[model samples]
Target: MNSLDTTRIRSYFDFPAAGRVVTNNAASTQPPRELIGLLQRCAPWYENVHRGQSTASRRTTAMYEASFDTIAAWLNAPGRGCIATYRNTTEAINAVMYSLLTDFRDGDNVVTTMLEHNSNYVPWHALCREILPRLGRRVELRLARFDATGRLDLDHLASLVDKRTKLVCCTGASNFFGTKPDLSKIRAIADAGGYPQPTGERRALLLVDAAQLAPTSALDVQALDVDYLAFSFHKMLAPFGVGVLYAKRHLLDHALPFLYGGDMIADGGVTTETVAWNDLPWKYTAGTPNILGVIASAQALRLLLDMVMPTAFFGGSGPLPRVAIEEVMARVGRHTANLTARCMAGLSEIKNLRVYGPEHRTPLVSFTIDGISPFAIAEALDRRGIEARAGCHCATLAHRALGLDPPATCRLSFALYNTPDDVDLATDAVRETVAGRRRAGRPRPGRAQVSTAAGRPT
Candidate 1:
């Protein structure tokens, strides 16, 4: 298989010039210089959307609203009416929780997995434990466990769902485990549960947290048959502060809005007697939205394809070819997979280093050296100019389930811009850090006393 032209891709990012080895892509990818430039280009047309009659407001509104179309096309949703913007993946998932707050019956339940990030898990936890109980509802939140190798236990998940299950929320890819659950099988399980919803459906609604998956995969909400999907643009190449929630047309049409205020109401229809909501998507967009962020996030999707392939697709609008999207993402997935494999191979050679997740998984590896704190490992890697992340990575449940003392692991994740050499440098740094610790006697106790020596643990 051919590799991506990472040299050309690296040139588009400013991080390479600063001697930074950005391997923490699963957390957030570095924005390309062109994306930053695009933001500046929009400065001339600065105004709030859906407000005044001035040319600036009209132009900004057009661009901002068109952004919804671009995002819908990227996800292969039916249309822009199915899309709603949010601050991030956490907020997007919260929106779903709030929208269906009253719809959940007293005896109903929500089924999620141990492989989820807190963004997907915490909201349901709060709904079942804190919020709903206070409202005199006894909604149960069931958690499905993972296998010994860090894969989602399908049988365990199937056993958790029943007729009373209202929703099944799962992550498209696990941030800590790097495991991608088979969505089709999950959809089937959800359907077989025969849960009755207010919308006359007999199956539990499927909500996929695609935060980690969307950055490196081709996501089609229609093909997956997911009722709701959420992902953040910062994980891809876009700037921060923009996330998306794609729901079926009927759901958005019938489900209550998450927030209500200004623009969500119909034009001049806010009478004292009764207030009518706006159209499909506008009804979801309350207040003056993040106009510039939405536009930039849509453009980021275009720029991602252009960055992967040699052809230019930026500064355009309309539906992207599914074939083009698949081909580009396939190339990206293969490249990152190869880099991750190399890192795993190198890390496995080091003594007492325990790597989490399956050997073949997403383009990331989380591991810990025995007797060494992951925080110290991250700091040592930082001194060596390798940007990696440590902690539960918002995957607190999975880490605790694995019996990790501090519930943390040091993670090195890859992206399209990361080359094979970057993987080598990172793994080599880990080996050195571990070896230095062995030479310096036993590991020390406490956080402040941990060693920062290259290849050494505190």
Candidate 2:
């Protein structure tokens, strides 16, 4: 497989200059200097969209609205009407829940999986357990289990879906296990449920949390046939605070607005009798939106193509071709997979280290040492200038299901800009930390006292 030019890609970001190994990409990626520069270039045109008649308003509104088109083209959506912006993935999923709040029937259930992040799971959990119950609805929240290898148990997931299932929420990829579930299969399972919806469809809606999947994979929303898909741009080299929720155009038209205010209403169409909502995409975008963030985030997608391919596609405004997107992301997947393989191979040489998930995974690895706390291992790696994450990573259900008390693991994730040398440096740091602990006679503690420094049990 061909690899990305890591040297050239690294030069686009300022992090590498500080000698930082940014392995926590699953949480968020380092923003390119060009995206920062793009933010500055957009400063002079700053104005609220759909609010005023000034030139700045017209210019900024055009760019902001065009951003929706760019994002829609990135995901191969029908149009910008199907797209909605949010603070992050968590808020995007929450918007879905709120929009469909009154749609759930008394006996309907929502099927989810242990492989989902908390962003995907918690909202449904709250919907069924907390919110719906008070409204005299006994909606069920069913959870599918994962297999020993951390893969989503397809059979278990199939059993959880039935005619009464209203929605099936699953992660496109596990941030902890690094496992990318077969979304097509999940979509089929959701379809087989045959639940009648207000839109006259007879299939359960499928919502995919693509926070991890979108960064390294070519995700075509129409090809996947997902009812809704959400992801954060920060996970794909954009500045924090911009995420996308792509739904079917019809779904957006029928579903109620999550947040109702300001520009969401029709232009001077509000009155004491009734307030007509605005057009598609705009109705979902309530209030003064993040004008600069949306433009920068959309440009970040363009910059990502340039960073991966040996070409210049940034600083332009137009539709990104599906062929170019597929080729660039395929190269990114291959490079990160290679790095992950090397890192896992090197970690296997360490005695008593237990890595989670399958041998082939997305671009990250989470593992635990038999005698060492994950926090201590993370701290030691930090001392060696290796940045790693130690926590449940919002995969709390998966960690708890695996019987990990306090529910945490140390993770080292990679991005397109990370090189093989970065993987070697990380694994070597792990080896030295383990060996040093052994030489220091640090005995393994009992379960009762084997707590994380944050006081969570391990």
Best by lDDT: 2
Model 2 sits at a Cα RMSD from the real structure of 4.6
Off by over 4 Å in 2: 442-458
Q: For residues 1-458, could you state the per-residue lDDT of candidate 1 as single tens digits?
A: 35799998899999999999999999999999998999899999889989889999998888888888889888888889999999999999999999999998888999999999999999999999999999999999999999988999999999999999999999999999899999999999999999878888899999999999998888899999999999999998899999999999888888899999999999987988998999979999999888888999999988988888766778777678878888888888899999989999999899999999998889999999999999999999999999999999999999999999999999999999999899999999998898778878653565344557754543
Cα lDDT of model 2 by residue, 187-250, tens digit = 9999999999999999999999999999999889999999999999999899999999999999
Q: Tell me how many residue pairs clash in candidate 2.
A: 0
Which segments of model 1 are wrong by more than 4 Å? Answer: 442-458
Model 1 residue pairs with clashes: 432-455, 433-455, 433-456, 434-455, 437-456, 451-458
